[model samples]
Each structure stands twice: as structure tokens, then as C-alpha cells.
Target: MKKFTAHKKRVAITTAALVAIGGGAAFAYWTSTGSGTGSATTGTTVPFTVTSTTATGGPLTPGGPSQVVEFEVTNPSTGVQRLQNVIVTVADEDGILWTDAGGCSYKDYFVSDAVFTAGDVAPNGGKVTGTVTIKMNNLATNQDACKGLAVPLHFSAS
Candidate 1:
């Protein structure tokens, strides 16, 4: 009986050792490399809107005090827009290049362009104010054709 019991214990120990070795071997794996691909998209940029607000100096007179032309810029885009400068030009009543008539035209006026420090305008409804001086230059010739005529100004922003 003693001999039979010892043989049984030896058999169980050998089976357990075989299981531990086999279990470790079962987890072993081969290392290798592979690859694949991906994709994406982007958005678009738009222009700004400039509008004249009011004039602070005067009804222009030849060789008289210059008027400060006040204006504002509107950012209609969804993202912040960069503002660099605002340029004011004398436009016809129809907002185009003035045509010479009775000696009154764009050539008779001088406008100082307004420059701004580079700044970011907020998205949508963001506004910034600027001013340019407009003067009727004292020409050597007559400018009576401009008397009582409403000056139309065109504003642009960049």
C-alpha cells in the first residue's frame, strides 16, 4: 500500500510540471509589423464689410478745415478677421469713380488713408472704427460746382 501511494504522488507531480511548461508555451507569439491609411477636410475664408458712419468736421469748403470721415468695419465671417487698414475714397453719388462735371470731381479732393495696428476682429458682428480726413483742396481754379453738393465717400478695409 505504501509503494502504491508513493507512485500515485509522483505521477501527480509530473502531470502538474507538464501543465505549467505547456501553459507558458501556449502563450508564446510571433511579433510582426503592418499599416493602413486615414483622411480629413477644412474650411474657407471670406471678405469684410466696411460702412461709413458719420463726419465730424464740416460741410467741406475749398481751402477750409478738413472733415474727419468716421467709419466702421463689420466682420461677417464665422472666424476672427485680421484688420490692417481702411482706405477712404471720394465716390460719386452712385458710389463709383467721380466724373468731371463743372470742374467738381474726385481730383479736387484729398483723403488721408487710415492705417490700423494688425488686430483680430471677433467673429460675426464684430466692429472696429476708423477715421480719415477729407478735404477739398484749394485749387488754383474755381470749385463753385461743388457748392452745397453732398460728398459721397467709399470705404474699404483690408
Candidate 2:
């Protein structure tokens, strides 16, 4: 093996130490801040009517098998538009909803901000309000199912 010069050895050791220290620091940050779980910065602010929000679905016991979120969107602008996309998330938890494709339906499941838009709000008397359902897997086994799920229904006239 080729022997490294004294200076070269010292430099190599220092670089290795720096890398180790950097990795440790990063790990510390992740645990301390819990920043990856639904960081507030990820939510999109879409306009829609603030209808009633209800938790549906899930197992049958005290716990349950899934959860459903229902909301209403009113244009009030008297225009005729359609609602598009749905983005639902839970804080500090995985997203538990069904909305992979783009359109208006309460059957598909998954987390999405997919584009819930309502466009035809007739001048001052146009409005649309409906219920959207979100399903959750075995809530009993997961226990921490709906921990960090936040759903903001976004829509526009189409």
C-alpha cells in the first residue's frame, strides 16, 4: 500500500470526521423537529364553501376501518363551473383518502389536491355543494390512522 504523507493523512481524517458529524447533525434535526410529517408549508389554499366536515368509514368496532370527509363548495358568483381535484392529508400521519384520478367522484381512494375546482358561479347566484368520501385502511390495526390528515377541497367551474 502506498503510504500517505503526514499532511495528506491529516486531511483525509478531517474530511471523514466532518462527514460523520454532518450525518449525526442531520439525524438529530429530523427527530427533534419531526419536520417531514405534514409540514405546514405543504398545504394549498384553495377557495370553496366551508361546508360541514364529517369523519366516515373505517372498521365497525369502537375504532373503525376508514374515514370519510364531506364538504360543500358554493360559488356564490352565479357562474357555472365544476369542482376539480382533492388533496387530503393528515398531520404526522400518512394520507388516507381515495382521489388518484381527476374528476368529480367520491369513490376513488388516495390523498390528493388533484384539482377540485368549481367554475360556473353565476354572477351572484351560482353554487355547488356535494359530499366527497375518503376511505381509510384498517384503522384498528394502524391505530394512528387519521393522525395528520388535512383535506382542503378545491374546485372550479368546468
Candidate 3:
């Protein structure tokens, strides 16, 4: 009976470890402070406007069974501002999506690949802009796709 109890303990410990390893960041966030509101891709109010957006180059590749997306932002904020270090989350009819750290090139990534500082949207927010690239392979590349698939990119502060 003692041996049986020991065996059960080992199994339980192993199972707990597997669950934790599988938890990943999503789990970490949940286990921690849970949910918190943050930034949106598009800034609003009379204070700021994204201004313009342009693609620096063509697709990174043949989509790599996934797509590498890039974003260009123009700051027109009338107040002091800095890029928010965070995770850009997108959810659509397909499901949820995001870029991993490897997909990130910018600094101040408190989570995933979110960049927090490029320039500043100060008393006269900088025309400040930068690029964030993420691979979208989980989505289907079928003939028929969901119309207006919503991608909500969220960010956190450093």
C-alpha cells in the first residue's frame, strides 16, 4: 500500500508538470492577474489618428503555409505617448491568432511580440512609426474565406 501511494504521488507530480508546461503564456496570464484592458490597434478621439499606413515590401514569402503580416502606424496623438509593450491578439470567425516572440523584432516586449517604444506621441506626438510582423499559419487558406475576419491587436505597457 505504501508503494502504491508513492506511485500515485509520482504520477500526480508528472501530470501537474505536463499541465503547467502546456499552460504557456495564456495560462500564466490567467493564473496571475487574469484579464486587464489595454490598447487597440487604432487610436481614437480628436487627440490622435493613425494617419497613414504603407507596406514596406512584398510578402515575406510564399506565405510559408502562413502569412507574415506587417503594420505601419502614424502617430497624431496630442499627448505624450510611447509604444505599448504587449501582445497583439486577433480574433476572427476563424479563431484567435497572434505573433510569438520569434516573430517579434522590436524591443520592450512585456509579452509576445508587442513593441512599446518607437518614438513618442508627445505634446505633439511624433510621426513615429514602426513595423510588427507575425506569421498566420493556423488560418485556412481555402477558396472561400470568412468575410471581414476581425483581428483585434492588443498591447500591454512595459
Against the true structure, whose TM-score is highest? 1
Backbone clashes in model 2: 57
Question: On residues 1-158, what C-alpha lDDT tens digit does candidate 2 reach at each position?
Answer: 23568778889999999989987784333435344444454433335454446556653222234455565555454344445543444322232333333322223223333223444444344455545544533422432333443433333223
Instruction: Output the number of the lDDT-best candidate.
Output: 1
* Per-residue alpha-carbon lDDT of candidate 1 for residues 57-99, written as tens digits (9 for 90 to 100): 7678988988886777888998898998776788864568774
Quote each prediction's TM-score: 0.73, 0.32, 0.32
- The deviation in Å at residue 7 for candidate 2 is 99
Q: What global local distance difference test value does model 2 have?
A: 0.44
- In order of listing, the candidates' clash counts read 0, 57, 5
Task: Provide C-alpha RMSD values for all models, in order.
Answer: 4.3, 27.1, 30.8
Relative to the true structure, candidate 1 reaches a TM of 0.73
Residue lDDT tens for model 3, 1-158 = 99999999999999999988887535333444567788758644433333223323433222332333344344455656655543344532233353333332212111136433554555554544444554323233331232223223442222
Off by over 4 Å in 3: 1-48, 51-75, 91-112, 115-119, 138-158
Off by over 4 Å in 2: 1-46, 57-64, 78-82, 91-119, 138-158
